[model samples]
Target: MSKSVLVVLSEYGYWAEELVGPLEALDEAGYRVDFATPTGKRPVPIGVSLDPEYVDPPLGRSVTTAEMADKGRRLDASSRLDDPINLAAWLPDRPYRSEPDFLRRQEEYFRALAAELSKADRYDALLIVGGSGPIVDLANNGRLHELILHFYRTGKPIAAECYGVACLAFARDQENRRSIIDGKHVTGHCIEYDYKDGTGFEGTDFVIGPPPYPLEYILRDATGPDGAYIGNFGRETSVIVDYPFITGRSTPDSRLTGDKLVEVLDKGLRTWGFVPRTGVVAPEPAAAGDR
Candidate 1:
């Protein structure tokens, strides 16, 4: 049976390579990919991600190659992103405590959520694309939090790249309010990658100078004392697979992240990107064209 993946993207803006990389990998693996957005809007790639001449500040090089830029533009123009699943309508929202009949509404909310989550069974994996857009839409999104929690609880592979990884840290059990990745190895956008200025997403009038928050710090804390956040600093790219969760560090790790997720599905890969479960410092795996 061909496996299917439920991919969640930010409507405001998603990094071009972040989607193209993993998407191509998944397509090559013959997996059916479905897309979902917070409000069912067509997601657009950030302008910089499609600009081949735009050099990445931290990397000091052009991360988007001409070929990759074309691919990104083609993908954006295609019908793949059309009619994305509307998360707001598909998932149930928790009731406010002050609402009338709060107790009954709360119970109903949970029941409805259980039913909606059952839809996750249709997918073998879930992916959250990364970009500055996620900070505005995907992060701290209650509906998305529930969906991520559902995928984790079911043992389905959950893949997140860049800022999308923030959703994983935010998706915690209501009772404990602890991060779902509380004791799981993961990686995300490090502090150094924060843009010095003009950090913006689509459908926005203004840009937040630098990322509003540091994802590295949040991941470090979310991992708790036992679980470690592997920044893999100085590496060309970073992709870590710790059981059902596979995380990528940034734009460069996009395709690699998709490849690791495929390994987790096809080869039952459970652990990687760590030295004997240590915090990090793993060697970079050779990419397809590297050799």
Candidate 2:
């Protein structure tokens, strides 16, 4: 069976390059990829390529626009910014009340995730792409926790980038165990970037948490003091791995993040029941003394 992958996104929009880039990579690699959003609607890019804050006025903006236009023009041209997916199309939604927008949105994503999980036998991996929207849609949602737990329990390769890491904090095992990422080496959008401008507009408009929301601050609390990890020194850091979980800080790491994700997925596939028919294979033990 062709390897199938589920790509989860935040419905709001921003940082289109982050998810689009990795998605194109996966598509090119011949993987079957599907999209799901908090509301099961077509996800939108969080900001315009030309948004002043989105990129440096001159260099960053033009460069980013060209890159996204070249890579994600389909996503760009798609008119339905709020396109909806049938969250009920997935099984998990059957158990939830569907009135509150937030609850329904959360259930849509979790149900999509559950649907993906139900296909474990047919799929090879799952990738969760992070963006500004996840802070609002993905984190702190019970549905997200349900989906994360499903992936964690199945021991599949899970990749999260940028705000994508927030979902990990929500996942707990059957015993109510926290996700493995809670105490593992991981990084995401740096706190410096959050406060470098000394303005909280970013958080106010994009993210999920109480007042004074910050990814780093939440991670610290989630880790519960002395968790093994380090991050955000002078320069930016992107991409972090803690066993089954793979995370990336932001867009710069998208390519490498996708590559590493494929690696992990390949490993999982091999561990399950896949065997490569071609490519270099470990030589069967030669004569006992051939070494």
Candidate 3:
């Protein structure tokens, strides 16, 4: 049977390669891919992501390849994105605590969620493509959290890159409401790669501030005590495969992230990248004295 993947995209804007990379790999592998959006709108690439001449502030070079730019444009114009699964319509909503009959409604909501999660059976894995847009709608999305949990609970791989990985950190257990990634190894956009200015989502006009939060800081806190967040600072690429979770640091790791996910599915790949307590250490914070 051909494998199927459920790919979630942010409606505001997704990094061009973040979606294109894995998409090409998945297509080459002959996998059936489906799309979903928070509100059923077709996802567009963040403008700069498709511009080959845009120099990345951190990398100090153009990250977008001309080929990638063309691919992104053609894909955006294609009809494949015409109709995405409407997350709001497809998933169950949680009732507010102050709503009438809160207890009954909450229970019903959960019951409905359980039924909705059953749809994960149609997929072999989950991929959340990333960009600044995810901050607007995909992260902290309760409906999406439930979907991520479903794939996780069923032993299926869940891959996320850049800001999309934030969803994994927030996809908590309903009862504990704690991050599922608390004890898992993962990677995401590190502080060093965060833009110093002009962080914005395509869906909104608030376009001149840095990302509201540094993903590296959140990943560090989320994977505390037992787990580790590997940023691989100064490395050209960072993609961690810790069984059910496959995480990529940013756009540079996009294609590799997809290739790793393919290995996880095709060859039973279990663990890759940093081994804790084996002389491996996460990047350290500088002391005030060091400055």
Candidate 4:
């Protein structure tokens, strides 16, 4: 049977390469992918990501090749992303205790939540595409947290790249109030790659100077004492796969993240990047042409 993946995108603006890299790998692996957004709106790639000649502000160089830029534009214009599932509408709404129907509504909400979470059975894995956009929306979304928790509880592979990894850091069990990644090894956008200024978001007038929060610090704290956060800055691409949780450091790690997720689903591979009790040995870098 062909595996299916549920891919969530940020409404503001997703990095073209981040979405395309994993998606291309998934497609090559014969996986069916579905797209979803917080409000059901079709997500768009950051305009600059489609320009092969556009220099990344932080990197001070053109990271997107012409071929990759073309591919990204094609995917953005494809019908596949035309109508994404509205995650907010699909998931149950939270009820306030102060409401008159608090008791009854809370019961109803739980029932709906259970029903919605059961839908995870249809997917072999879940992926949250990353970009600065995710920092604005996907990171702290309650609905996204519930979705991640559902996948976690069901033992389905959960993959995230770049800033999308923030969601994993913040996804915690309601009862214990502990991060789902509390004791899991992972990687995300390290401090070294963070843009110094000119952080922009779609559908907003403000262009922030710096990211709202430092992902490295958040990931370090969220992983707790038992868990490890591997930055792998300026080294080989960083993609960590510790069972159900798979995380990628940044744009360069996107394809590897997808490849590892495929390995987890197809070959039953359980561990990569960092292993507990044993020290980490960095894997040989991918071939130059592979990027």
> For model 1, how does the per-residue alpha-carbon lDDT over 87-175 read when each residue is reduced to its tens digit?
99999878899999999999899999999889878999999999999999999899999999888888899999999999999999989
TM match of model 1 to true structure? 0.97
The Cα local distance difference test for each model comes to 0.90, 0.57, 0.88, 0.88
| lDDT at position 63, candidate 3 | 87
lDDT for 246 (candidate 3): 96
TM-score of 2: 0.69
Which candidate's TM-score is highest?
1
> Candidate 1's error at 163, in angstroms?
0.5
Task: Kindly list the per-residue Cα lDDT of model 3 for residues 1-291, writing each as its tens digit.
Answer: 999999999998999999999899899999999999998998899999999999998778898999999999999999988899999999988888999999999889988988888877999999999999999899989899989988988899999999999999999987887788887899999988989988877867888667998899899889877888888887677888888999998987888888889999999998877665442643432321121
- Reference-based lDDT, residue 125, model 3: 94
* Candidates by lDDT, descending order: 1, 3, 4, 2
Estimate TM-scores for all models: 0.97, 0.69, 0.94, 0.95
Q: List the residue pairs that clash in candidate 1.
A: none
Per-residue C-alpha lDDT of model 2 across residues 1-291, encoded as one tens digit per residue: 557877777666646677776776687778887666665767666555324345532223332556455555567676533454433345354233544676667657555665565754455566777665676667766555666666667776787777677778666663556655665556666565453332211224533323246777666666554343334333333555555777676666666567667766655422111112221122322221111
lDDT of prediction 4: 0.88
Q: lDDT winner among the candidates? A: 1
- Candidate 3 lands at a TM-score of 0.94
Error of 2 at 84 (Å): 6.9
